[model samples]
Target: MKKLLTAILIFISLFFFAQSRPEIGGNFIKSLFTDHNAEKAHTYFDSFVGSQISVNDLKELYPQIQGQMGNFKSILEVNNEKDTYYFYSDFEKSKLDIQITFNAENKIIGFYFIPHKTFDKADDKTALKIKSDDIELKGTLLQPTQGDQKKLVIFVHGSGPQDRDETIGENKPFKDIAEYLLKNGISSYRYDKRTYSNPETFNNQSTVEQETIIDAVNVAKYFKANESFKGYQIIILGHSQGAYVMPKIAEKAQVSKYIFMAGNARPLQEILIDQFEYIHKIEPSKISVEDIQNIKKQVEFLNSKKFSLDSPTSELPMGLSATYWKYLLDYKPLEAVKSIKTPMLFVQGGRDYQVTEKDFNLWKNQLKSNKSAEFKLYPSLNHLFIKGSGTPSPKDYEGKGNVDEIFLKDLVQFILK
Candidate 1:
């Protein structure tokens, strides 16, 4: 997920260190993988890192590479881009790619372990256009060839500039979901995200309402106004960040039901902190004093009261504008859910690292007494609702997979009921 990668990049880029040195970057990465001692490796990597991830986070992630990929072999290739270095390496079990970004002083400010590659599969698709206010976007409408077109679903993507397929690398999860739904006598509508279609519009000031909610509202209205959809039961299916904001979307868009897939009840920034800590908990090791201090400083900034619409991007996480953070901080998904009277279904994956079971439990606990709400948990599924074995990693998304059949069935049942 490019959006996921961008978020991580933002988190790591906050540390401003020294200038780039190819030898320094290469040696630092080599030492981290070969040393076999996270503490010792931290000494080498920490000095290069300004402060983006906690030493604990690195410790947990470092070993997982060896655990999954086996011992590192040799660096197959290295590509340099400005102050950043991209290293392609071979492991006993598989290949891995690592990216390191450096500051002017040659210190490491960003590090990333990219997951495996994704491949695209061909599917039958129908072209469509979505219009709202001055925005007109391209999209696809997928449906079963023989069905009565009784049920219609709109897929709203997670954060970032996602296309109608919600494409990540070669994988198109939304397209897969839509096709699966079509096979089951359901119709779906998916469009290129507003940001993807019109990046210039968001160059200046923007809010969640402007960027996402309005577009969603327009989509629903378009479907409703069309005579072809007159008798269909309309559903809004949101994934990840999309799910997080669905409740708010419901406030403006009149729809038959809502589906929240891997959604979080907590604020976005708070969830990010939890995600960082989860990375650390999975692997425990001694961290350097400097790294610990850096993590503390970063957390302090997120928790401070100094943030406002006018706050500089440098003060915010990922250098996002103040307007963006202010909207996320002020908008509470769970609070919005409390006022929504529409029937809702929550689906969660047990192995999902991004939006974990904790978030699922939060929704369950909050909506427990509401008979209008239902929940489903897939213990073997990842964030994309794709079933897999072993501990789920970002690599799981690299392969071709469909939304769990049971999940699609449940979703169909919910829409018809």
Candidate 2:
């Protein structure tokens, strides 16, 4: 998901630049992929980057595009014909559409790309201004087209920074869900987490309970006061880490129901360990048992305030940060959700290595033992609940697809029934 964020940010930045670039931005992109002289390519791109941006910035997001994308010979085929193509050039596929259109001046005027049906059409968001405790939170209000004010849903994004759309991997999961729900007449509210645009306020921080919990509370408070949704019982839809945090938020916010999409049912540490093990099995792998054990040692190294973000690469594995690993392990979802009173719908995807079948089954047992939980598994779906096959990888998500059809059907049923 982080990988996808980098790509989307780069794509968005390029899209914005394509509008007013003094030099043809399309040509710049083409040169980036096709040019053989790494130095010249690097220099050309550096010359155009805005003053506020650093050369190292794009490097973090698109090192793969600049360094590795142009290396491979890729094949494109239709019927009996075989066509060879390189990426970064404009092209079309059944799912992905990309192009650069021109104006009279021959400068790149409109660069367009569309990813089709990227997620479920969530119900439409109603516009509402939610006021709370000297803070005004922007709310994307959703209303069911058919149902009475008895049912509504709210969406909260996963860990890391997220907008209302839960933007990741170059896909807008929340937008897709919002669009889908509108068609089905299910209402929803997805808002920006307090952590965003206010990171400095949380920089020194307090107990790091899920920040989205605050969002969940605020949205619930919105539901409480809004005349349009006066009689409805609010449901919270949380994805990934949001799932971990939602139960507490639901209880505190006084919501009546909750949904967990691609959620985990185990301790975060165990899940992270599982994720590492899954990715370690990939060819040209970056994870190993030795690395895992070394990472464990670094926990002590980090917690004692001895770790440095700038530690030499020789001290640790490539791209592994002690500070980040230490921080991630602290979240405890299983503990948070236990004994929660609200009804729940737990959705899991088969191909999702980020959160596995094991975690799903644990949730199944926990929910089954209780009268309030319902479970559904999509065997071919990935971490995003998108219909998928085989192992989950960075490449799989690049191809366009919607969230699982079964998940959509279940969502409609959950609200309707």
Best by lDDT, which number?
A: 1
* Residue ranges of candidate 2 with Cα displaced over 4 Å: 1-136, 144-150, 195-197, 204-207, 286-291, 299-336
| Stretches of model 1 off by over 4 angstroms after superposition | 1-125, 280-299
Best by TM-score: 1
The digit string of per-residue lDDT tens for model 1 on 148-205 reads 5589999998987777887664457898888878887889998888787677788538
* Model 2: residue 184 alpha-carbon error in angstroms: 1.5
Error of 2 at 268 (Å): 1.8
List clashing residue pairs in candidate 1. Answer: 18-103, 18-104, 18-105, 18-106, 19-104, 19-105, 19-106, 48-108
Provide backbone clash counts, one per model.
8, 18
| Location of the lowest summed lDDT over 10 successive residues in candidate 2 | 77-86
- Model 1 residue 252 CA deviation in Å: 0.8
Q: CA lDDT of 167 in candidate 1? A: 69
Cα error, residue 360 of model 2, in Å, equals: 2.0
